[model samples]
Target: MTDDQRPGEFELIERYFAPLAGPGGLDLRDDAGLLRPGRGYEVVVTADALVAGVHFFPDDPPAAIGWKALAVNLSDLAAKGAKPDGFVLTIALPRDWTEAWLKDFAAGLGTLAGQAGCPLIGGDTVSTAGPLTLSVTAFGTVPAGRMVRRAGARPGDVVLVSGTIGDGALGLAVHGPDRPGWVAALDDEQRRFLADRYLHPQPRIALAEALQRHASAAMDVSDGLVGDLAKLLKASGIGAEIDLDSVPLSAPARAALMADPALAELAWTGGDDYEILCTASERDYSALIAAAAERGVPLAPIGRIVPEADAVRYSGKGGGQGFARGSFSHF
Candidate 1:
């Protein structure tokens, strides 16, 4: 089509996003969305931003980027034990934006939105000179006074995490320019497994109900187990002795570590694993495990909360070790 026939920002929204809008979206014609929590429920809101070069490679597929942008936000809601309701997206794009890219991105976003039962509400779009950026503010709901908090762990609470860790970080290494020589030791299937984990994180929304029932404190493991756990400890006024060896690792991560034991530290400190990390009392642990198992999600107990205040230590087969870095930091 000629320049005059090309779709503008508003036109694109109506064409690609309006259909995905739910009851509160008002057909993309309104300035803001209208959302009301269900009776006896409170709204839980969280926002996350992704920059093209910073959060993802510039050459990554638009669809994957779309899924990730929303998935990360959903992960936050999952940590709070809230059921997702809706989200608003704001995107700043380079001048050369094309209809094809937007179409695929919208498709990806819509698929996850439908699966999570969270529909798009409303958002802003604009042109930018720098890298593409997408921000999503997601809303969820939990029974009044039932939303989980980071500061609820008690001294005797057991530290547990959903699913295996380290896959996302290892996946990044495999996709990076200077991937370690040990990566070559991994088979083709193993390589793809790691890479896929990096591109698409499976938010543990299925475990939210169980977490609300049993967890004393909870948070998603976006930054790194070591560092994020430290944050939880600080918030809950306790310490933890994480059994580094017991920290769950995916098969691919395990294979890579076996090839190069040094990769163990990277597995511990590398970030981007969006699994839920939580603390629950021993009495509730069995029930939590049963609940998660029914949802086909694994719950691994990695450590226990301690009486000491604000300390996180790692102990492996050879005693204690120090991580080069605790977690990913942009600044």
Candidate 2:
């Protein structure tokens, strides 16, 4: 390419990068992004990345990708009951990414940060020889001795989940291949609901903070409920009994699972739900819900922690109850 035809990185950033970087907050021309936390605040840091085919689909929208990339990291902080301070983003762009695509991506990222009261601090951008990837590191702070940990669950603590579950997994089912049973019965709108869930999962940051204020144990439901809850129980050195009928599936999910009994296991094993599963004393449950409601968030009671004889158990319909064994696992 001729000298004039070559795209300068700075010029490319200004033309496409600055706008999406969020409204007039950061100076894209600076050597580094700026981050300023208020006095007396201690920062907590967390990071996560999504590979195009691995974490998300190739057809996923730029805005949703940007929103979710930040949301997932924020969810971690929320589980710790932290206040978001800011975030940094690193993007591995495909060689052919148009200026418009970058602009949209930046805009999407900016919008999420602005609304969440977290600023985009700084990050790197590089050309990727392979599929697109986004990495975001989020920062936050909380009062001393206020952060919740997974290891705090006491036996007899009531287990709770924020919002419904299984929607995202159902969303994947609708978009991907039809499994032997449940996926086939979904109508177009039902399929769309599931697909949207898979594409867009809201982070439970605010809810996490609320839970930390009152919960003995707290975790985000990134993996299936049974799986993630089991992790929390293991961390707390406790065991739990989750009523299968009380697993809190959405209407679609309930209907779908009802259609294929085998898929009930899939619902428990599927990952990427992004809700919050927590445990609190029965005395604290109302308070937890009240705090969440003050922030306009929803919380629900689903199960309870028991002695550690078995890791987890499930009691389904028709007087059925048994061990869960495990949930969505990489191995």
Candidate 3:
């Protein structure tokens, strides 16, 4: 299009986003998406938003921001053992919009959408005087009555987590303004590793099928292990005893903790891990581990569910530790 014929919002949708639209999206020319789940399948819907100085750094790359906005929501669906189907995106842009930034952001979002087998359906865009905000509502499908939930954990069930914890939290410590002094001990490679974890979290979508087959209760850990686990336990009407020593840690996080043991609390409570925290019967735990391993995803048994209601106990070599704050809070 010529400069004088520059596309407006609707035209922009056709030019840039329409290509990513699925059948339900009606080529982005409809008032709303038309989702039709197959027989014996239920739709799983999850939404997450990233804000300029809140969910992510304001100066972070637009592409990374786009990936994270979609990935966080996908993580939720993964926990529920759902298969990606489609999504809707709503963006609030600053008054001064740049085509280059939009192009990069859409590319990042579209790439992941395609990879996950989820297509863009419909959404809205608007101008905002405040910070840029991107919201995504992703849709998925799960077999009827098989969706995993946070309320199915029972006493004697094993608590497990996929991949390492604390990496995302540590990554934030490396780049956040209030970073601990100990972050200085990290070398360039270590810093980059942690920062990348913070910038790009890998959603464990590959293990959803295994989760449905084995996990009794499941949730994606976004608000720190300690707090998110507590939420899960409460929902299940039970309690847990977590071994602080067994909470998985990435190599970079381990090195940082070795530099300053005090960093352990931050690692546990700092949030943004995006790993799956699940509970399964001891009889099924081994099979679940094997299944996840077959897919090249590591599932670590960290603790066990207890009969005590609504209580989370922590124990390790240093004795018991408590957190003044359990998880990340927007308020």
Candidate 4:
């Protein structure tokens, strides 16, 4: 079969990208996705890109590529306490890509956009001699003057997280050949859990709005907590003391770390959780939990922000207190 004739993009898009009526009317194929924010709402925008062999592995599934591209961009809007509206896409395809691959990729993007109430309005496609790349721009709206920012944290604000951490980092450990047999023997369910965490990170969009009502400052956990929190502290001009024992972990994560002590370090430094991390005054703690409950997101208190100390500290139950290469640094 010729390249263009097999499993065309239109057919894949119809199955995955066609619009439906949810909280909003989704129209993935339309010239523009319609959005009507409530009265007194303001729009916010963020964009991100994932390049093959850099941001993602070469063998990663096409559907996953689509999901991660949109999810990462949405997390940025979520960090700003905005309601997702729609998005635009730009995809660079390798010259040898088959029509089936493009179809699956578009379908995957459509699936996520539908679930997140963000329609794919418009996009550009180009053939490239290098690796494939996907870029997405997401738009969201927040009530006038209610959007949250990283700079709002205060010295006494409590540090909190929406869900567990470290699953994605541990997943990367299993991806390598040097991993132990126990890790290599992980069952399908365990493998799938980590795989999904790495591929389809759940952007804390609804949680961002909930946080706006009570959180003094907020941001999504894109980079590991240590690195991301540093950014938060820098924005707020404060320092913090995190209880290492308080960091949450999934069942698989705990197991993987037990097999390899070094894995714990990876958990703290590894990124890609996509959960919401926030800070709020003690007075706002109960209110913040209440707001999160109303949105059906569980909020967990992980630590507290202290005065502007010269260093960040991590306190453990039996492991003592100090930063253990606490964050991921590009340099």
Candidate 5:
């Protein structure tokens, strides 16, 4: 359809998005969103962009696509020990866009948005000749002086990761067109478990408060654990030695690994796991673990910060591992 027949941007937004708007969004009629700063609290903001066939499969479910666009940013907020507040969204649709697609996407997004207590604030809409693109800039609040950062870790701090790693990575493998022969070892439930993990990221929002009380330095393992941990350590001007055997794994990932032990590399190095990777002082480590366990999130200790500056050593079959391009880089 030509531009003349297409619905106005405002009409589309009001129909599919305005209902998701948070406070100060002015029902999408205002020039800007206003989020008054809470007394004694600070705001944390993070953004992530996803493009068709880049961040996600072009044929992926529209709802999953919508959920992921925001989840990734929320993961960032979680790493910073922030709680959901509100967010702005930007979407660039290709020529073949439709109202039905937007409807389903909004439903998918609203499902998680409501669950997470994050709301849409305001944003821009436009047409693009390129692939479908979506971006979310999310805002969250943490008590003043309590927001977590990636530079506070010191020597002797223990490295801990929440939940299992590699599930999302294995999920990606199952979703790929060239499905690995090891896929045969996984049952239908295992396949679904891995695939769903890839489609929906479980941001450790519940563990945010615990992290604030215990974590010295933290960041979500959006890339690979090893690479992201390296980044965190570099920020703190420290190093670490991790036991690869201790890296957490889900049932499906373990099954796949058992079928093909070599998949350990992909499981350990492939990105998409949104779990929180953090460092905590050994003294506060128990509190952190207890907090995570209370929230029903598994906390695994994989390594410890060392005095050697900027060194990352791992012991396991994955020893001497090196990423060709160093984790998932859109660039």
Candidate 6:
């Protein structure tokens, strides 16, 4: 078979991507997917791109690569308190693409797509000279004027986060070779937990209802917490005081942190955590936590939104201090 005809584009789509289609997908025959927000609703859309060796290692499990691609976008929708509508996928397949890899990738993508009720809509496939690259444009629906924004945080609003922080960065450390000397402290179980975190991140879709009801402002922590928090504060025209001690940590993260206090910087500022950093009124705090709990998501209050006029701006207290690292920067 010629290079261009290697499992021809249409053949590939029909074999792999079409099975993931939802009602709006039109069975992969149409050029565009269809979705309606219905009365009293709005559409929430988010797009994320992943490149080999940049976002993830090329040798990583095909299934994991597929899962991470969709999960990251879902994290954004969840932060906005939107229900998963569906997604369109565009992929640039490199010359090395194999049928087996694509099959496993589809399986992984379908698992989460099914779990979150986000199906594959319509998209394109093309050959690329560069690395294996993938992009997904996922959409969601929310009640009119109910999608949360980072600009809504007000003074005295409680700053909260869902799930434990720092696992992704820590997991990345032990994920591959050239391990930091500090990694010596992690046991086999600890290593797996961290590695799993890096490989498969869980998007908090279930917490959308709670956030819609209580959040004043919210955003996903894709770029380290402190940096993402800084962005949110700037957007909201506010500052915050985060209690370093209160930042939630998984047992594996805690153990890793104890091994080398320096890891705290990464845990605080490293990227890929994908947790929701949000704010709500003090009066709504208890209810929000309870609501999140009902969904099996752990919601923790780490700080409070402060006026932008505060002299301290964004400061951390207890145990670890300083925002010197800011967050992972692409530049």
Error of 6 at 206 (Å): 0.5
Tens-place lDDT per residue, model 1, 200-240, is 89899999999999999999999988889888888998888
Clashing pairs in 5: none
Can you tell me which runs of candidate 5 are displaced by over 4 Å?
1-5, 22-25, 320-331
Clashing pairs in 4: none
Q: Could you estimate the TM-score for every candidate? A: 0.95, 0.87, 0.94, 0.86, 0.95, 0.94
Q: lDDT scores for all predictions?
A: 0.88, 0.75, 0.87, 0.76, 0.87, 0.87
lDDT tens readout by residue for model 6, 1-331: 3365368777878898888885445678677788878899999999999999999999899999999999999999999999999999899988888899989999899889988899998888888889999999999999999999988998999999989999999999999766998788989999999999989999999989899999999999998988898888878987777777788999999999889877888898888898999999989988999999999999999988878532223335333345567732211
Candidate 3: tens digits of C-alpha lDDT, residues 192-283: 99988888888899989999999999999999888899899889999887787888898889899999998888788878899999999989
Worst 10 residues of 2 by lDDT: 322-331
lDDT of 4 by residue, 1-331 (tens): 2266554444544553444223454555565556567789988888888899988886778888888889998888887888888887777777677766766776677787888888776665666799998888888999899888989988788998887888877676566435656585566788778768988788887787677778899888877888888888888887777777888888888777766666776677688888888998999988888888788877888888887642466677523533355542211
Scored against the true structure, residue 41 in model 1 reaches a CA lDDT of 97
Candidate 6 residues lying further than 4 Å off, grouped into runs, are 1-5, 23-25, 309-321, 327-331
Q: Which residue pairs collide, candidate 6?
A: none
Q: lDDT tens string, model 5, 213-273? A: 9999999998888678878877898888888899989988999999999888877777999
TM-score of 1: 0.95
Comparing candidate 4 with candidate 6, which one achieves the higher TM-score?
6
Clashes of each: 0, 3, 0, 0, 0, 0
> Where in model 2 is the C-alpha error above 4 Å?
1-8, 16-24, 177-184, 318-331
Compare candidates 4 and 6 on lDDT and give the better one. Answer: 6
